[model samples]
Target: MTSIKPGRAPSFLGGIGSAFAVIFGIFWTAMAFSITRHSPFGGVSIIFPLFGILFIIMGVVNAVYNFRQATQKNRYSVLDITDSETEPDPLNERFGPIIEGHVFETHQGDVEFEAHDDGTRDNRRPRFCPYCGDDLGEDFRFCPSCGKRLPE
Candidate 1:
């Protein structure tokens, strides 16, 4: 029903997770140091220091990873609700067809290009459906608007 927008930034949950990881890392590292230096809890298990140190390392790694994710541009961590019924002829209605060396059509209609001196037109393909002219987003095998199967 929903998904992350393309080229979006990270979600707020990522930052929250990163903050938790950093706090946990600091806590465990301090605990490990304390356990190794002066046994705060008497008769503590021999593995307490090792376990604390291991968790400290893991937490630090997780923090860094989460922080990096949170800072990425256009990389969202949540699904966003979208309307499938977008304007079909948005480009044709707005900018119309552009006439350069090639006839660069807008987003709504088919794009036509003129032949260059090398007797070849540009091969850049649109991400939308050439048949129904619908945006083919990231994970669809078929066009939602029309029942056309998209090329993989």
Candidate 2:
């Protein structure tokens, strides 16, 4: 079975702009036609009808653009989309510890984990540093490998 993810909603401003453009376009076109047909006004300029046509074209363009934008998947990640290293792995534990002076490959780069006297073992290790993939302890306040401050 295929699961289709929900797409982002259309922009409010785009929708509103399209609606107003179409409505005003229709209104102006109608007025232009009326004036050309010898309405109460003596004579009407051609700019009104030209503007109405332009607005109608603009409305159609806006609607199409908004529809395409709405159907596209919105990704906010700063990393490259093709970079699999930074992709989320739900199966892997968030924290994995490595022995001090041990080097491991990571999405960021070769990271060396720091060893602590906290009895951290293979199954009970932190996965990587939250800021970068370095060895971190559960009780760590700062990453000794990268020198980044860690959360308490």
Candidate 3:
């Protein structure tokens, strides 16, 4: 398998789309004015509707493509609560052991944090480690390699 690096959205495509949107607005306004049979904006009146339509189509296509790029499999959007447990639930009391790791999932993948903690001398903050909970160092807020935020 191949790994993909996270990168920012392409600015070129956005610039082009934004340009089209602006042109679309201009053409739409001109066309509306022309259909009113009032050529107030001057000479470009003849192709107003044509430009308007072209711009609209291009702009829509660009938007769709950008949306798709933004939602790709490797992109991380937010955290999800995968599994939880409560030793016992009492009225007005919270459920579960302090808190456990989340079964993180992304569009293209999933990551599991195991509790690999020895639970004795780990000076790290409260977090989940694969075997027990001893593997994670407290210096970082999120997993340094995978970017998973340590559960509070």
What is the TM-score ranking, best to worst? 2, 1, 3
Put down candidate 1 lDDT per residue, 71-149, tens digits, no spaces.
6654543565432234344554565554445554445445655556766776655467745678877777788888877
Tell me each candidate's TM-score: 0.34, 0.38, 0.30
The most accurate candidate by lDDT is 2
- Please provide, for model 3 over 27-121, each residue's C-alpha lDDT reduced to its tens digit, 9 standing for 90 to 100: 79676656846766666565666667767677767666565556566553333333223122342133422234433322222233334355333
Better of 1 and 3 by lDDT: 1
What's the lDDT for candidate 2? 0.59
The lDDT per prediction is 0.58, 0.59, 0.50
**In terms of TM-score, how similar is model 2 to the real structure?**
0.38
Off by over 4 Å in 2: 1-13, 39-45, 74-152
lDDT, candidate 2, at 133:
66
If candidate 2 were superposed on the true structure by all CA atoms, what would the RMSD be? 13.9
Winner by TM-score between candidate 3 and candidate 1: 1
What shift in Å separates residue 79 of candidate 3 from its native position after superposition?
31
